[model samples]
Target: MNSSEIIPSLEQSLITTDRDCIQLGSEEVATILVNLKSEEGEIIEEGGADVLIYAEGIEISETEDNKDGSYRAFISGAREINEARVGFRLDGKPSTKLITIRVQERCPEPFIDFERTQLIAEPPEILNDGKDYSTLLLQLYDREGRLLDDKTPVSLMANSGILSSTVFDAEQRLFTAFFRSRRVGEVGVYVSVRNVRYPVTIGEVRVVDPEPPEEEFSIIPYESHTMLQSSSLYLQAAGSPGIDSTKGIHLRWMLRGALGELHLPKGNLAEPNQTFNRSEDYVKIYRAKYSKVSFTLNLNRERPAVIDHANRLWIYRKEETREIYLYFRNAAKYDSLISNMSADINHSNFIALYHPELLEFECKDDLFLKLV
Candidate 1:
């Protein structure tokens, strides 16, 4: 109270006369000014004050009193992007109005920080299917933990049985690498800056064979049929070369009758139910109830013929004899939904026109058939 009653108070503040922001790597002088006012509402000549400064990500090299209720702060060596506050108090009274100083990067040096790098795979694993692919994401940064603004080219190398391509998005500071596995094995991926001596391994991808089908089981026909006709039929079967654990199996029933041509269902013929085999390994049994059979006649043409089933039953005349074919394959699932293989079924016995239709067909490779 005694000092407040005798001395004037400091009011109105300004930094660098008008500027409040400074760029990094700059040797700039910032000045703070305040007006000393007397209790009688008059400007004071002999005003005394103590100045204080607070700053982050930057250093305040020096501070000087202007001897007229003002102060000057020297700013240098900005370590990061941040702001600083400067203020003063007159005659040990309350502090005057504060001024802000913003420090920004002047020049950016772009590079990859392998120590703090992050990598992510969309599906997290690769399958043996040639078409089953995964997306790899990478975020790049500089030595100072700051995101690099400029686009940087990165080189990528992979171990055996893997294919990849790199792409960078400058606006988002994100890099994406598309990868596809050729075989089932452990694949290592690495990245490096141009001209850098050693490359760092981004991650290791485990390439696994597409799950094999369960062993051949039994196909149980719930309904008896000697003379094929338009009728509701229920059937169930158990077997192996089984469905994939993660990706279920694609099952379809094809029937060719004496009167009607080859018949294929619109969707999957059987729904897989979990079952245990004699060896205690988990297996799947497929079952379905068909109200009616739909058939499409295969045309004799050089190119593969496409059949359009208009969601109707292709019924056969009463007393007509028919042959049934059961087909099962693998499927792929992801973050969104499952992408099923093409519905077209290929037979190895292309020349045999009247042989018993192959119930369980196995392909040497992962790609069974492509869905149109």
Candidate 2:
């Protein structure tokens, strides 16, 4: 009985059958894993704040209960995000999601270490359409690479219908919804690690209807120069005569009363009127606005990047008393987080912003969700 004692003795002998609604075909999918304890089964609980999991999705009220079969499957992508692994598929395929992961309060230790839940579908926001801009993301990990100090909170839900609640900003792991633009159709977004003790859930889909109008020579992807977008939207492409060293001269910097374009934070672009410069506490120059040729951020560097972070502290930009000061996240950590127009500090914040979004069910793309 290896395989972790046969998966908790087959996930605690699952039973809720009329074959649990069998008769499935026409692309059937059944994955049962329910253990939220309390009806008798125990995972742990000793008090205050615990209803850890009671995930129920796949409920069909009263349509004759579908002739006693109970089923759900439909996806088309103006946006789509779904996942339940073990045999899950809506099209992308792998299947599993009779999904239940409950934990009511006290499981100090015994059995609770099963993590491998994933589903990430995003398109919630990232479209500029003002001469390029649709990729400026976020998400980095170590949620518990070992934790002795990690105030956890990773909850996101957009299971697309109308059941909403997602607005995280634990210092910019940003998830917004001032009423999510009052969506109407395709929707499903979920990601979890709430009620801690290593509880993780992932599933997503948010393809509503109201964003189609992009046609003027399209094609933009930083899908993976691989992760990094803490804040930026500067583009100024066109100017490749030499020096690429691997990809970095496609710049564009806009923000002079800016309005409809922002999310192009440092990816690969900077090399035309090359005379760039960088210097933590002061001295940054990128002069080169050759008629929309882009590169006009000469703030002369005095530290205003939300208090620099290479380990923090390096904010000092004094346009002669227009003051801003704080130094030592390595005094700008060897500057060069993307240069052009002469000046240097230690460039390597390598921007990519939350990469790994493939959830229809997965046949390829391996599944890697972290766009928060």
Candidate 3:
């Protein structure tokens, strides 16, 4: 009979048995018989072909050629599998059609593989102590519960900190990269994988100051005069600066012996004259010494006033009334928002009487959340 016809005949009349001629049980040892063939409808002779078998969870014990265009194989396994295949090569040519088999039998345990494997960081947050770094662990897995051998390079980047190495050897997936703090902001670490279009942020680190002390300084009034006088008033920094880039001290300008309190819209140290711009729609200054002016230094908004200073005043009668605006700004003098009101001392629609207004605002450094 031809190879195709012989295979079907042998399969129909095949007998299954163990070494003791007993029927095989579920997940137990089994001996199977397979007919070998060539592509030209000819039977493969003994020692004329090399056979191969592929089973996901099964182990092959042994195989023997029957010398009559047939082969026998012994295999044992306890894992449930859906499909298996048998292949052979004859006359220096591999078989195009492989023998497929169904291995649907009761298994002791089911096999599973990881999906969308990822690399992760242990203890995602770390102190900026400059000595210890986070450990990067590879979570890749296979159905066999073995570590997959991979050699692809992984790329790394940081927004604000320093990384010891940028390229990682994926084969030795478990590794540690040293990190150094460069500034007082949040640090983010990113990783790029092969075939991935965008990089992923894996972890973050926060660098903080170790219990900063309270700021000590004084606000020096260089020049002072009444609203009627053309002479200008200026406040300068006398000692070490009281504010940093991330925070600022509050300076409350007050007025006594006046119909309404004085409002210094811009108490800028660099340009004291801009604080008294009279043409602006906002009330830069209130009615003269008849409207008096003073200032109170506040190191902390939660605490009481630290220092207070007042300027001597005289009355002045002006032609028209000017507007006043309460301007909000950050430590870097960035204009945030402004509120306008009529400068009329009687009405004082928007101006609060002797109320503490904030001129220099505190804000967080933008570099903290910046992406590389």
Model 3 spans > 4 angstroms off: 1-123, 127-132, 138-150, 166-175, 194-197, 213-372
Poorest stretch of ten by lDDT in candidate 1 = 329-338
Instruction: Estimate, for each residue in 86-138, the C-alpha lDDT of model 3 and write its tens digit.
Output: 44333334445333334553322322133434546555555555444555554
- Rank candidates by lDDT, best first: 1, 3, 2
Query: TM-scores of the models, in the given order?
Result: 0.29, 0.16, 0.22
Q: Pick the candidate with the highest TM-score.
A: 1
Candidate 2: residue 333 Cα off by (Å): 65
Give the poorly placed runs of model 1, Cα more than 4 Å off. Answer: 1-111, 214-372
Q: List the residue pairs that clash in candidate 3.
A: 282-323, 282-324, 282-325, 283-323, 283-324, 288-291
**Candidate 2 whole-model C-alpha lDDT, 0 to 1:** 0.28
**Candidate 1 lDDT, tens digit per residue, 215-267?**
22223333333233222232223244455423444454333232113122223
Determine which window of 10 residues in candidate 2 has minimal summed lDDT: 354-363
Tell me the alpha-carbon RMSD of every candidate.
Answer: 25.6, 27.2, 25.9
